[model samples]
Target: MAQLIRTPKQLGVVIRNAHARSGLTQQALADLVGTGQKTVSRIENGHDGTRMDTLFAIIAALDMDLQLGPRSKGGKDISEIF
Candidate 1:
């Protein structure tokens, strides 16, 4: 399933849930990403701003892909330009 993440908090929640589903602890994910556990914790909590490189690393490590698309309209994908 694809989720449109419009906020950092949403991204945080997705990553946290994904980590759990993958059976990885904060420390384990940190080790995989070559970062600190505290950093992962902060990111999961959405309290600490994360670097783009780090965010991409985390996403990749979790076997997730990030996509960019045109803005949605009223809770639906914009399929018509007119």
Candidate 2:
């Protein structure tokens, strides 16, 4: 399934969910990405200052792929969930 992420909060939710699904703790994910647990916590909390490199590293550690494309007009809007 595909999800549309329009805000940092939404992105955080996705990352947190994916991390849960992967059965990895924030500390564990940090270990995999060679960062600190606090950094993972910040990213999962949607801290906007997160560096692109760290973001990519965390995503890769979670076995996730970041895709870019035109926003789908037919998919569920993230606002509905919040």
Candidate 3:
């Protein structure tokens, strides 16, 4: 699924929702991602800047895929042009 997360708040919502949907507690997900509960909380609350590797680990733990692409131009829909 392609999601347009333009801010930290949006990203936090996505992460929190994914974690909840995966039925994992903050601490549990943190453990799986080799981080601490506080870190997870911070990320979920959009407070701290999470490392890319840590973000990927969290995504993996939640069984989600993260893709990067350019934003749309001229009001066009964002699409993966790569």
Give Cα-based local distance difference scores for all models: 0.86, 0.87, 0.82
**Pick by TM-score: 2 or 3, better one:** 2
Runs with alpha carbons beyond 4 Å of true place in candidate 2: 72-82
Question: After best superposition, candidate 1 residue 55: deviation in angstroms?
Answer: 0.5
What lDDT tens digits, residue by residue, belong to model 3 across residues 9-53? 677889999988888899999999899999888888887578989
Per-residue lDDT tens digits for candidate 2, residues 1-82, read 6787877877898999999999999999999999999988888898788889999998998899999877556648656454
Report the error of model 2 at residue 32, Å: 0.5
Candidate number with greatest TM-score = 1
TM-score against native, each model: 0.85, 0.83, 0.81
Provide the lowest-lDDT 10-residue window in model 1.
73-82
Stretches of candidate 1 exceeding 4 Å from the true structure: 75-82
Candidate 1 lDDT, 8-76, residue by residue in tens: 777799999999999999999999999999999888887657898999999999999999998656644
Q: Where does candidate 2 clash, by residue pair? A: none
